[model samples]
Target: MNQDNRYVICMKWGSKYPAEYVNRLYNMVKRHLTLDFQMVCLTDDTTGINPDIKCYPIPELNLPANLPERGWKKLTTFKPELYDLKGTALFLDIDIVIVDNIDCFFTYNAKHEDSVVIIRDWKKPWRMVGNSSVYRFKIGQNTYPKLLTYFEQNFEKIRQEVRHEQAFLSNYLREHHHLEYWDSSWCVSFKYHCLQKIPLAYFIPPKKPSGAKIIVFHGEINPPDAITGGGGKWYRHVLPSEWIKAAWQ
Candidate 1:
């Protein structure tokens, strides 16, 4: 693979995630990959990040500044003028762990001609597409303007229709045929792949998948809170301490 053609991309904003998470992800990628690749973080702050990472500012979206903080920020991935990136870029959430080599994610593509490739949620079988937790795309293609346009025209409709960006992407891509669901083994759900909770100590922790390349912390459970098992009242109190230790170390 050409060194210049690959990228590991992530985003961060607000106090929820620390800058070190981005740095740690860079370390994980470097430790696991044999090929030369750039690890880029599109963030609002650069302090505390490793020098190896190319930090870029999070692009402004069409949404209002006063809007409540939700997962909609992820939709910026589709903005053409914002990112202005190129080549095969793998988008990973800051809350995941890289257990196996993720170099293959860039190589895989849809059978048809499409710019975006993602994974289908196994639980929601009827849905044509899945969450965008881990996805690959060619920058500047502007393959996702329809999503932005939809939000622009039907903001209230969307607010009532779906709760997050993933839901919008799933529906929009399903209509356009630009969506491709990846193999289940490539990305596994944390709840399904690891333990939810321990009977005693409330601290037995979760287990990592045998050969899973990426374990995504979707929904309410994230890395920091997952480690402490202290997200909120509705969240499950499962800590994947062993998995986190093995993958990050």
Candidate 2:
């Protein structure tokens, strides 16, 4: 209910994604978000990030170092009393590119105060699974704690059942009656929505999807890769997209 408490928070960790990713995300939010809110980054290191964005240490997930990284650390974002953050919190993955005004992300769900809004999984439309790259939730003593607590207690069983953290979260939130999805067009997937498919992908340059507000880059491709049109493998070649370079800054 406190509109002043609105925050756009993101996470960054390790050598895979540097501080620049967080910095770019902050710049994007500042450019597109006309709403009054704070910008935050939760990470192990904050070197090179701009000071305007509030930085917070990522809470420990308490998992063993020997385990495979299936993005389980993201669950820590749900820790009931996360630092001093309160009210509507938008959790964004560092790899995403904002292509249009995102003030709607906060206002579109203004009426559904209890709904946990996320982007619907591009691959699995039949099931209620959602892509966690972009999502909105209240930042206090809501039902958020249960997601992390349940995973901590049942990691062995959970890791086998779900492919990754987003999959587990999508199903759990749906079953708990807290799941809501953003409009499909607002958060379009770059791989599925923008790039030409297969054979055509080789000749045609990636086109920015019309009316897309936030272009999500998941799995093998990222913004850097989109600029060069190299997906790290021969089969995934995309013609360089000029629009990605324009928006990523």
Candidate 3:
């Protein structure tokens, strides 16, 4: 693939996340990537975003208007016709910190003809990949249709069996030989990499991994609230303030 044909993608909507988060990601990608690439934010609101970051309107999947809120809206990334970018693209959640160069993620080899490269969830059983906090894929491949079919055929079954898109994706790719595990150290779990409050909140942050490229904020805690440690909600309370501050700078 032409190295110039790469992109960094993220999705945004509603007020839960601020628009600056999207702009910050754009800055992170610009600082870390050495190749000719574009940073694309798929969003419903484009106001106040950095002008350099290209914005694509989020595509509407034809799911029922009253579909229960299962956080499955994120599955929209898998829509082929919706994303027309060529070659390989890396998708990052806006809540993450790009502490190191991400150019390598673009270069890692795929495991199979239809494989997607993602970090294996070490905390979960080896058979199950944890979350799609960060993943890379080729555009216009229609990966979403296969995913939708699984939900359609096993709608009730999946609702009872899985809580998130990652679980469904891991199962689908496992069956198709299209799931490749990224090197463990390349992507570190925030709970493990930062502070773990088992005994107390006194755990000092460890030295950043020598070659790790990304730090994912998967659940609850995120970069903004993590860096401040001031958000009152229970979900935002476990953040490692010092760690995120240093990582973003």
TM per prediction: 0.85, 0.94, 0.85
Whose lDDT is greatest here? 2
Question: Which tens-of-lDDT digit does each residue in 123-195 have in candidate 3?
Answer: 7655666568788877656654576665656766776888777887788777864788778888876656654
Could you give me the TM-score of model 3 versus the true structure?
A: 0.85
- What value does the lDDT take at residue 77 in candidate 1? 68
Question: What is the Cα-based lDDT of residue 167 in candidate 1?
Answer: 81
**Candidate 3: stretches off by over 4 Å:** 1-4, 66-68, 142-145, 149-154, 196-200, 203-207, 230-243
lDDT of each: 0.73, 0.85, 0.72
lDDT per residue for candidate 2 within 133-222, as digits (tens), equals 999987865546577878888888888899899889887876764788898889998888888877888899888778899999887899
User: Where is model 2 poorest over a 10-residue stretch in terms of lDDT?
Assistant: 107-116
Question: Lowest-lDDT window of 10 residues in candidate 1?
Answer: 231-240
RMSD vs true structure, all candidates? 3.1, 1.8, 3.1
lDDT per residue for candidate 1 within 34-88, as digits (tens), equals 8767888888989898888888888777665687876787777677544546666
Greater TM-score among 1 and 2 belongs to 2
